[model samples]
Target: MKWTDINDIAIELADSQPDTDPLKVNFVDLRDWVMALPGFDDDPKHCGEKILEAIQQAWIDEVA
Candidate 1:
């Protein structure tokens, strides 16, 4: 997968919940879809390690 692959989280959530309301999807479904995307496929963070690092460092940062 390309390193620059982009994602439309909202759209993916909606598509996965075609029969149900998008806003009402279960957390697991949304999380799974987002994680499955190529954009997030190569994520270096595992089990909140990176997030915990960022939080411990307490530095201002940007996602993209």
Candidate 2:
């Protein structure tokens, strides 16, 4: 999944880290976590603040 696959990434994160709070996640760690997810395949440099923010928001929504 690429950075554009926001909902898919969020779902994976929610399932992988059920105990973690998305709001408390910092961008650096969030980025790392996203990269670490299985099936995640994208250019790291393609990510930016907007993409991170969207992913974080999607994760929060997924958990909610």
Candidate 3:
């Protein structure tokens, strides 16, 4: 999944880190966690603050 696949990434993150809070995650760790997700395949350079914020919001929604 690429950075554009925001919902998918959020789902994966929600499932992988059920105990973690998305709001508390810093961008650096969030980026690393996203990269570490299985099936995640994208150029790291493609990601930016906007994408990270979207992902974090999506993850929060997923778990909610």
Candidate 4:
């Protein structure tokens, strides 16, 4: 998955971290978790605030 695959990444995160709250996650931890996802294949430098926000929102939606 690439940086654009926010929903997919969110689903993975939700499943992997069911006890954690996405809304409370910081960008540093979020970036690291996303990068650690099994199929993730994006450049770390490609991530930005907007992408992180989108990912966080998607994760919130997934858990909701």
Best by TM-score: 2
| CA RMSD (A), model 1 | 9.2
Q: By the lDDT metric, which is better: model 3 or model 4? A: 3
Expressed as tens digits, the lDDT of each residue in 1-64 for candidate 1 is 2222222434443454446543444445544555665445545334243432332222112111
| lDDT (tens digit, per residue) of candidate 4 on 1-50 | 99999989999999999999998999999999999999999999999999
Tell me the tens digit of each residue's lDDT in model 2 across 1-64.
9999999999999999999999999999999999999999999999999999999999999999
Name the better of 2 and 4 by lDDT: 2
| Lowest lDDT 10-residue stretch of candidate 3 | 14-23
Query: What's the residue-level lDDT of 29 in candidate 4?
Result: 98
* RMSD values, in order shown: 9.2, 0.4, 0.5, 0.4
Model 2, C-alpha of 52: deviation from truth (Å): 0.2
Give candidate 2's TM-score: 0.98
Itemize residue pairs with steric clashes in candidate 3.
none
Over the stretch 1-64, how does candidate 3's per-residue lDDT look in tens digits? 9999999999999999989999999999999999999999999999999999999999999988
TM-score of every candidate relative to the true structure: 0.36, 0.98, 0.97, 0.97
Query: Model 4 RMSD to the real structure?
Result: 0.4
Candidate 3 regions exceeding 4 Å error are: none
Off by over 4 Å in 1: 1-7, 38-64
